[model samples]
Target: MGALHLMPGTTFSNAEELGDYDPKRHASLTLRELERYIALEVVGSCHQSIHSGLGRPPIAVWREDEGEIPLRLPQDRMRFWLTFLPEEERTLRPDGIHLFGLRYWSPALSADVGRSKRRLLVKYDPRDMSRVFVRRPSGNFVEARYADVTLPSVTLREAQTARRTLLEKGRREVDMRSIIRTAMAQRELVEVAAKKTAAARHAKARGSKSKVDDGGWGSLRGVDSSKPVPFVEDAN
Candidate 1:
């Protein structure tokens, strides 16, 4: 990522520019920023670069090849998209399918539990690990969600991060439940901390709230301004 490259107008650029090292910067960049950076490379600078062997820009070559290439589209778009998703071969047990320390279950998968001996092809979306698509022997995909329906959806990165954090905290084995619990706890703590920070900032901005002067003698209390009568010294 630290590799140096020449830009269209700039003298040079470091790929590591995408990495934020400033302490003031957030822990992670937003997905939109990441996607934009990827798009910039995939369809912008990289495609515009001239290919040495082809004697033309990659984008020009792609445009020329587009007309000659046959576009074969699948009848089922869902399956087509599923084919591109990350896949893993998992055994479907009577209880359900276990993946990434999470359990997934679908009523359709129950009947095939004892009947099939082959491992089923499972595909999941990294954006939402709450559900997965399992390919059946009949060539149809069965959808399954979390075994614990109450569990909130989590991203693959979040799940991995939680696992690592738990490990660092001396957890022997981290599971999906523990990951969810940690996420929930972190969210609550963040909310509380944010409120406290905001309140403190507000108070600081307004300065001390303790009242000092009563704004001239017009606002002074009667008792506070009252003078004591002169003491009489008549032998007593």
Candidate 2:
């Protein structure tokens, strides 16, 4: 078992010789593919395999140890969930809570507005940028989602990329609406590009099967991409 350690966060490192899910070997490894590979590796194999130090599979050891003591659960599950998410200090303006050039608001936060000007504790999940947890003066956590509810949810990386694109286009100020539009447009182009690349690769590996999603790239078939549209310009 050489270097059989689990990777941290979003950076997953495969075993030295695993044929499947090797990023270097499988150049077209997608996010979904990584998730499926991890699910199989950890639950299907690792849980059933024997541990060198424990002398037994982890699941077996966990079951045997369960009778020793009862695990204490959190009284408030919402609070417990927010405890582990990434957090920051943010100002709660009348418009809403601002973070990463996006604005968040909640009906629960209306009562506290103008009472006092103080920075609120904010917690967010990086995977979903649709909502954030804000700690009010009363010390209770409230969900503050995007002020523009119609806007689609995007990851932190997507938002940042959109912001950078706006700056590169000579836009002095980048707003939330521009970020959303640019990110979504960029995502569409990515889907198209990925399909084009996959079609070329499929010609070579036609005999082999794949688990990647088609992701509606078929609709983009034969679409002319000679002149791609630029990112959404700041309307200021």
Candidate 3:
């Protein structure tokens, strides 16, 4: 299949520019094949650019201003939209593509879990089919919306191997809840400290103003005392 290279904000004027393009050739792809193609094209772009440092510019398949990429497919087949990040942004971490994430939208919810927010959804773990509809908040996995997949059967040894791979890939050791809680606590502390500093500044200003007013009153008292003795004798 010919590669489709889409640039952001540019109109794809040349359907002919898709050199040796043959839609009929891939027309026989099954639903699974199409899904796999979508996944591979999107994730492969990200992985190659980010991890490999292969000096390729990221292609923006979906126009950002368009809100979402609209895909029209046969009613019987599942359809999805794929978007990828730029090469430079993708390589900050080992699992940067996974951490960065992608959105998957389906017109009909899959049979696994029947919660119907079939509009737009994000997935972090592309390899793990079980993590199909889970959402991430700020580079951390927060919650799963319609998680109803059975765990893949694997031997204990295989599970251990997978765990080791995760650790090596910088994907493991994330205590998301603890990290969020600590961040919140730190933010609250900063806010409280700011309020206290402001209050102290106001108090200092008031104290300085009070001292100036007291000095003015003292001067007035001295002048009154100097003039009071003569008025008091005349009244007597």
**Residue 84 displacement (Å), model 3:** 15
lDDT of 3 by residue, 83-157 (tens): 231121221112112222221222232322333323223433333322233222223222232121223322223
Q: List, residue by residue over 106-211, the lDDT tens digit for candidate 2.
A: 9999998988788999999877899999999999999999999999988888898999999999998888999999989998898898788778766755654743
Per-structure clash totals for the candidates: 0, 0, 0
The lDDT per prediction is 0.71, 0.76, 0.35
Query: With candidate 3 superimposed using the best TM-score fit, by how many Å does residue 217's alpha carbon deviate from the native?
Result: 29
lDDT at residue 21 of model 3 (Cα atoms): 40
Query: Could you tell me which 10 consecutive residues in candidate 3 have the lowest summed lDDT?
Result: 85-94
lDDT of 1 by residue, 36-90 (tens): 7566666665567687888888878978998899888788899888878999999
Rank the candidate models, highest lDDT first.
2, 1, 3
Number of colliding residue pairs in model 2: 0
What is the Å distance of residue 11 in model 1 from its true position? Answer: 15
Q: Could you say which candidate leads in lDDT? A: 2
The residue ranges of model 3 lying beyond 4 angstroms of the native Cα positions read 1-172, 209-236
